[model samples]
Target: MSKTFLKKRYGLLVLALTASGVALATVSQPDLPVAAAYKTERVVQELPMPKLTINANASSYWRDEEVRTGDTLALVLQRLGVSATSIQNFTKSSPIDLKTLELRAGQIVSARVDSVGDVTDIQFFRDDDNGERNLAAIERINGKWQLNTSNIDMETMPSLRSVVITSSSSGALSRAGVPVEIRTSLKEMFSEKFNLDELVEGDSVSLLYESLYFRGQEVATGDVLAAEVRTQGKTYRAYYFEHGDTGGNYYDENGNSLTRGFDGQPIENFKRISSPYGIRRHPVLGSIRMHTGIDYAAPIGTHILAPSDGVVTFSGWKGGYGNTVMLTHDNGVETLYGHMHAYVRGVNVGTRVKAGDVIGLVGSTGRSTGPHLHYEVRINGQHVNPATVALPTPKLSAADLAALKKYQQKTDETMAAVRGLPVMVAQRD
Candidate 1:
């Protein structure tokens, strides 16, 4: 080939575009957004266009190759026709070592190359241990390579699967290409409905969940959106809903929560009810007053257990209540414990506590006649009768039920589109 032809073959296609115009619109809303989520505006203006060429006769195009089971940046780029210099720049100039980058088997590494095999730009996502993806890129800009990074939200689609159990649940799910993560999620999602381990030989399961994708390959599985289980001629269906207060939880067809609820009362070493939650005669004030919380008659220094999983919001002295502790749980529920004799060591604001965890002790620190615990349950800042209170589930919300119906309709449509072909790709709304 002529020198002019050789020089032209190795020419680079400069990107007139800049990363500033790259709008990566992310829908911060959790699983299954409302009707307004029909529009997805992610990557409206990417830095490098899909395909480009220097001349009509040039054989150049963008190529996307998946990282194999045991592959490195050098091996994958060499197979993608990237030059030695560009490959070196990509490995050395990346924010993290490209070799040390944890690349999943099906991860997509994209590159655009010229006819002479010199890469113009290369891009891929590097995921942390927490499964969050950050875009890392190296592009030839102004005759020199430059790196860029930003938070990324991968493409999500509804993945449908139907399988019958003839042997074991894990074996059946694994044979159907369901990842172990998704399998574990399916078990937990349907634990309240039916035990996955107890599924009989003829039992069956139909599921709909999110499949995260990059470059047309599924990289990971997301939250379980909906599922159905059929066993012994009985069918149970569950749909996931995102409540305004509760982040995400599953519910049955009649809007019953499938999440495992809190164990019973807050205190374990209880003796008797000195005062119930309501209007009653105050022993210390010596007047009829509205008692906002239930006073459990327990010995001083008795252990106080958290009703459920919650974050400590307050753990200090209050005016009349003296030493107090407050916990904030999901679904707009908050609990307050007053007149504590002593607090559990390391119990403070922002500390997470699970059910049956010791948070404080019971004592009549405030204006009280004897040793007792004043426990209050509040829903949306309004005091309620703690004696007759039950934890509210996400399905009880009218707005959540309506949104769930809409999501169910959309899911049916998606499933109908692939009646026989179970595995298909359709962008989530």
Candidate 2:
């Protein structure tokens, strides 16, 4: 009975397992449509692409043009697309006195334009001989325009040289084939120490001046880097140095102050003067008067070098003094040059003239008897005879002293090398 019951139960269990397996297989498998039943359809659609078009007629809105020679304000405006009416109105209603078109060459003119090609604004910058810059601005206003002028303070360095032609005139430097530029610089450099008109021919000068090099070309003279001048067998050396604490100044090898306080005056660099410092019979005044400054009569216009760097306080006519230029130095010293024949055009009152700049030509313009520069030195408004004044030498810091020692060593070696080669004397003393 047990064997027959077991066989029937096993047969039923196998049939149930088979049915469950078939249901599980059907649930796990996915149903897909037949390739033939589904029609093969392809969709083709067009897209909108952006087409970029650039306007070829539009000109550049900004431009820079260097002011060339013979370029006037009108021409510059016209070149920048300023309309005729705008130009006329600018000329008419402009507050600036445009009668004198003072535009100069080598200046930079910047213009801003609008979409309609009208100049919005224009700026012109020009440099003057005093190393200061003048900026003129033209702006559009209510279909018209206005011009404004302003000044830009600039530090200028001018390198100049001149030769001594005669033993009696300051212009001797210029006459002896010394470039006018250098002659002017020499005057400025020694304005405080001596008068240019008193220089004589036989004087020798050597200078190292600063220049600005742009694109491997010297664009302008910057400053008097260093200089040495020998007048009448007297050697004078000057060097430019910037103080770590104070800033820019000129000094000699000894640590003493070379700057005058007033504006233009002489610093130390000379020995005993030919003329003593005291009240005596005036050469030109023809009366007994105080000889304010000691005279170093070499020749006329030998090459008045600057005693120190300073500014021209007054450079025109003074009461009795002919064609005089007064320089105010940095160390509260003021110097005066009288009897000048002519002056450098750019130098004027309030103009910053560095050391060794020529302020004027030698002439007996004022109460002078001969072509000589009446030189004077004043300290704090008091006249100090430059001949007797104990000028202070510039001091050097320890670090600077060390550096100077190294430089002197190198300079000595260079001088020795040059001396070893050159035995030919160019000029006889």
Quantify all predictions' global Cα lDDT against the true fold.
Answer: 0.66, 0.52
Candidate 1 CA-lDDT value: 0.66
Model 1 lDDT per residue over 60-101, tens place: 577777677788878889999888886786666554665567
Off by over 4 Å in 2: 1-125, 128-131, 134-185, 188-192, 213-219, 262-394, 408-429
Model 2 agreement with the true structure over 108-216: per-residue lDDT tens digits: 4667665565565666544322212334456666556665322322223333333333455444433333333334544555667766567656665555444332222
TM-scores of the candidates are: 0.43, 0.32
**What shift in Å separates residue 187 of candidate 1 from its native position after superposition?**
2.2
Q: Count the backbone clashes (under 3 Å) in each candidate.
A: 0, 74
Model 1, residue 167: C-alpha shift (Å): 7.0
